[model samples]
Target: MKILQDFELLFQQELHKLYDNDEIKAIFLVVIAEKLGLNTANYQLSKKDPVDDKNSAEILSILRDLKKHKPIQYILNKADFYGEVFQVNESVLIPRQETEELVDLIIKNHKFSQNLNIIDIGTGSGCIPITLSKHLTNARVTTIDISKEAIKTAQENANILKTAVQFINADIFEWEYIFSNQHYHIIVSNPPYITPGEKKYMNENVLAYEPELALFIEESTPLIFYDVISSFALKHLAPDGDLYFEINQYLGAEMKDLMIKKGFEQVKLIKDINGADRIIHAKKAW
Candidate 1:
């Protein structure tokens, strides 16, 4: 067994080869804080505290998994988004900061306290809809995903967060069949937009650990989900309803054009924190 300080140093040294020094330091802080159930300052103050043999072994084992490129969120089974923590696993893509920006944009643009009907098409971990439901207390939020496991995980997160969100397991490609008459005041999706060819540009941690079902599109059908979801929005969105998407950073213009062609007015592409084109907002004119 080793002291918390020594374990942290060991984790940092072992992970530095896989991540930048700063990232390694951040990971150490997060992991240590999680293990000790304290914040960074508190963890720092407790660094000299000795860890039991079992706990130390578990920490080292987690480090080994990190070295294997597994995501820290998967190892921890939780991810933070919009100031709330949600359970996550391999069944769902980890919630990301850029997606939080999308959710923030929606909240800022909409009357959250109104009884708006919102549906998220690819609800992973229920982050988007759960956060929206929590903040927009009067709004009716519903989310659907193709994967049953993903929906199960999302429902669990919603329950844990004590947010009421209707979760459905249905593929967006065939969404019309089941929800033909359903209309939403707001429709959102952060569907799979990364082309398979973009795999080379991704970190091994993501490519190996994250679900490809939620990550990739065929190179030839780069805009497949965008095209499909935009079409679905055209038919199902209420008059002047809004549609939002977390889009491929590389295809912002293409997404805008696609929305425009679908007769959505005021189509706009927004950049995320990194200044990468990441989100699309559009309104149904009819």
Candidate 2:
């Protein structure tokens, strides 16, 4: 393919062939410009000249990566979630809009306390834990992830954002420590809830590029993470403490039912911007 003379025209034409979403395409173009050391804000501010030869070569390379179904966020090595930017790569699942809804629900409903303890399980990129730490000034956040690479990335993000989030590299399934007298006021997770049957439906960008350990659960035990996290909450959550999750839309009712069966009070399934059942919020019985 011939490299077009104009950057904007070239971006629009190249991305149109790959992504169906115009907004995503526009965002990708900005990412491409940013990667090329071009001031994206200035590029937008001024109808700038065409990208120079060096940048044109860079754009061509990025376009090829995008064509291979790599997510633009991964291409840019960053994504914005919950009013904060997080560095992301193939090691972790990209933060999604639905997870933002889960965070918003927790922030909106819970009353902040100076000594509130918050734990975020499966803290990919530390988006949830860091966001919570940022909003709840008095809260001390702890985040756990099994992947060493993911934990490293999350820790880097916490440092970059100047957020004090304690990160633990541990598998929740094998974690056997007890809090004893210590209790968390909030426990939140956006765990791997996608079932085996659904894996076939995911696009190559997700199935091929994203971490499988952060995306899939066995069909026989689709609620594996939920069950483990809920068990932990039952034992560790403070009386009347809240537990929140970003659930699989297809299993919203099942998640609510599990919480109810576990003796949680005020169990509620919440919808995201797309009106899909995406979040579940419940409080431990006092």
Candidate 2 residues 1-286, lDDT tens each?
3333355565667667556667545665566557554465655554555556776687778777877888888988998898788999989889998888788877776645666899999988889999889888689998899999999999899999998999989899888573446589899999999987997777777887999999889989988899989988998998778899999999988898899998899998888999999988898887
TM-score, each model? 0.96, 0.91
**After superposition, candidate 1 runs with Cα above 4 Å error:** none
Candidate 1 lDDT tens digits, 1-286: 5788897688777888789988887888878777767688888688788899877877888899999999899999999999999999998999999999999999988844489899998888899999999887598998999999999999998889998899889877776887788889899999988988888888999998899999988999999998998888889898888899999899999988888888889888899999999999999886
Superposed on all Cα atoms, the candidates' RMSDs to the truth, in angstroms, are 1.3, 2.5
lDDT, model 2: 0.83
Which residue pairs collide in model 1, if any?
A: none
Model 2 misplaced regions, further than 4 Å: 1-5, 36-48, 178-181
Model 1 error, position 41 (Å): 1.2
What is the Å distance of residue 240 in model 2 from its true position? Answer: 1.3
lDDT of 1 at 92: 96
**Model 2 residue pairs with clashes:** none
lDDT of each: 0.88, 0.83
